[model samples]
Target: MKSLVALNSNDPELYLLLRHILEAEGYDLRLLVDVEDLDHLLKVGRLHAVILDCTPDNESSLICARLKLGGQSTPVAALIPSDGNAQYMKLIKAGVDEGMLRPLAPSRLLQFLRHQPNGASADGELGVLAEGKSLRQHVLEMDLEAQRVRYNGRHFGLPPIGFRLLACFLKSPNRILSREHLIAAAWRDTACVKQRTVDIHIARLRRRLHAITGSEMIRTVRFVGYVLQPHKNTRNPGSDVFQRG
Candidate 1:
């Protein structure tokens, strides 16, 4: 069964509508009334995607941010009020997969769900995404299966958390990954880790990659998070060098 996480507080009508729509399409829906409930549900569920109802009182953006931080791979779709582009931007920065306006049409919800990864049970998992095999110095290439880093033909093994964090940056090169997203990607299960834990891992990854490539492979955007910036001379205009998610 395809599991889901829905965030909306006290809107029985909205919940009922979603239940009917999703049940008809053969989905097992899990309703989340608040952030705490959503956090609890995520621990035991292999979710497909999250449907966030963006009512004025519904803090869907914050909730989605927390879920993304917790390593939940479920794609998030935010339902905003018609005039709520500001909220939409916030959701996007929080790593939401898509956004729609309320009252949500059943067809739209189904459309978003259809595009998500079919999970491992369907057609096998999505493999490592790469632009090409030949990686240049200072550029990032991930072995998604082995969680190894290959730069300038040298290999550097990564810890599980570091690998996940680097994968987030590789998947979205040049985009600023906020500290919240990094934390969600690195330490999603526990809230006890110091916020500096992300910094520690990033620093370690940076040093290791630099040592292997003999160049600064990762750049830190002040007040923002890290990004993988390839050397200008190494870029191939026609060749696929950097992979994008």
Candidate 2:
């Protein structure tokens, strides 16, 4: 059977372009202009994937969050404006699998769809929680499936961005991660994110970790970026130890 994909968009041009591309590739395309219909459609049928047009108001981000929180595993891609840095971040935090800049190329759209669940490159891995895998770093354990972190025998929830930021740190423990690198990993290459924004988020993440570990796991490099120390170390003077930046 051909794969069925849904496009929730109000742009006629996008609809026509994607319909041509998808039908030519032997896929079934469904266009939905009204957001109200999405819930009903989800109840009645199965979709291989969903592509959303992320408007300035970001109604689509809410829809993507609903889909994920409702236990739907369908992959969601969003078409966003090139300069919509804030909107792009919101979409990613809302569980969008991919974001493509608007005036999108046909090749890019095709490539994204082809890697979806039942698409040509479907590798059975969906999101950050791929294959129920968990990431570990010293005393910190991240349950990707649960979107929670375990430390000191307690489980705590983090915002999606926080979770991703910590995952990046865990992947490269005991290494200094520049603000640029953390932005790329946590915000998915949103170039307009200010350095201060990274500082704020890192401060918030530090507070979350501090609540659990009661010791500093992240250290500031003074004019450089921050480093993740997997094992607790209080020997370093002038570290971000117990102090929120």
Candidate 3:
């Protein structure tokens, strides 16, 4: 099937440019001027990717957050202003997959879409995850392609940073992960992220995991860091599984 991409943009010129380019490359493009329309489409349609025009007043970042929180892993790319560092950071934290600086190049947008696992060619061949396999520990499984976490038969979505932090913890289960290690794993622009930010996102991840498993799977180690513990109901529930590193 031809990949379908949704463009949430008010710019007629940019829409025309992307439609022409994507169609030529064997993709179908849908242009949406309203955020409500985009949200509705997301609920009913299978979008390979979403392109957002991050106008100063637009809720592109908010939309990105909603899409991720709602368990939709469709790739989202934002067209941001040339000097939109603050906006870019907001979108990243909101779970946007990519951001292209405006005066946006059609080629760059095409390249971004082509790189997404969902953005396959007209021949229907699927793309692969560059990160390789899903991380599994006990009953918890992180589906990289679906971008959701499964725990004890329940599935849930997380913000991008939350997802990465959980992946780090899962990769080294029962081992303490320092803030620096988590920052390296979770944030692309780590220099600006403080240790406190890591704590906050970890708290969020912990809450989500708790909601799914109904037990504290992550244990904080004072000034050291945090470790992922096996579920309380698992075999040897009282065992000392947490390893400090």
Candidate 4:
């Protein structure tokens, strides 16, 4: 059984749009214009994520605040048009885990949901990772069958492209991986994002690794590509010093 999602939106077309984006292989979604079902599902811990399409009147922001008060850890993503800085801050204050603009990108949306703590998984649906030998590198442990990684005894996971990119690098440690190589390895016909998307995912992966190790894991090669290696405290005088972006 896929994980359930409760979607409540005031706009009919917006609700349908969200459903089309969210109701994928790993998710089962309930589309509701009213919040009673959402409230019940959330209270019972039956939903993984709630997508709120806020109206110009800010009804969904109020709903977001109410859900936060309900004390559920489930993520609430606000699907809204661009608002002023003040109104956007209000949405954040009201507890929107993610804010997405109009013309939603399903790939990005899926990435957000997959990384959420209580994400969906379908029945008998195996992990996206290939089952093989465990890739153990220091604090990193990859359970290929589970498609999950544990760092410092804390479990972690990433979106498909991120996972693929990390795996490609880990499988060939201490090697420079060009963006083109990564595109072939991590993204074949899967996503429509540009190669620069690899840079964003690499940056995210670097942050996660630094969180656990307190040092850089991946290094940018200036005009070249990237390379993943252990952070060296001391640097060679000939090599230029690299800083985090």
Model 2: per-residue lDDT, tens digit, 1-245?
66878888777887888898889887788886555666877876787788888787436777788887786867787887767767767776666766677677777677666545346444432243343466666556776544557874578766545677887787677789898888787664364456866777788789778877888788899988999885445333443332211
User: Per-residue lDDT of 1-245 in model 1, one digit per residue for the tens?
Assistant: 55554545468888887888777776767778778877677677667777787666677878888876665656677776767767666666565655566666677667556544453223211223333432232344665533357764567655445556677676666678877877666543333334555666678678766666666657888887777775565454553445432
Q: Write the per-residue lDDT of candidate 4 for residues 132-164, one digit (tens) a residue.
A: 645655556665545567665788655444567
Over all chains combined, what TM-score does candidate 4 have? Answer: 0.53
Model 1: colliding residue pairs:
69-184
For candidate 3, lDDT tens digit of each residue in 1-245?
Answer: 77888887778888898899899997889886666877877766788888888876667777788777777878787787756767767776776765566787677677666645555652211122225456677777776655567776678766556777887887788899899988877665454566866776787788878888888989999999999987648534333343221
- Which 10 consecutive residues of model 4 have the lowest summed lDDT? 236-245
TM-score for each model: 0.51, 0.56, 0.64, 0.53
Off by over 4 Å in 1: 119-245
What local distance difference test score does each model get?
Answer: 0.62, 0.70, 0.72, 0.62
For model 3, what is the alpha-carbon lDDT of residue 237? 38
| Candidate 1 displacement at residue 206 in angstroms | 16
RMSD of each: 10.4, 8.0, 5.6, 8.5
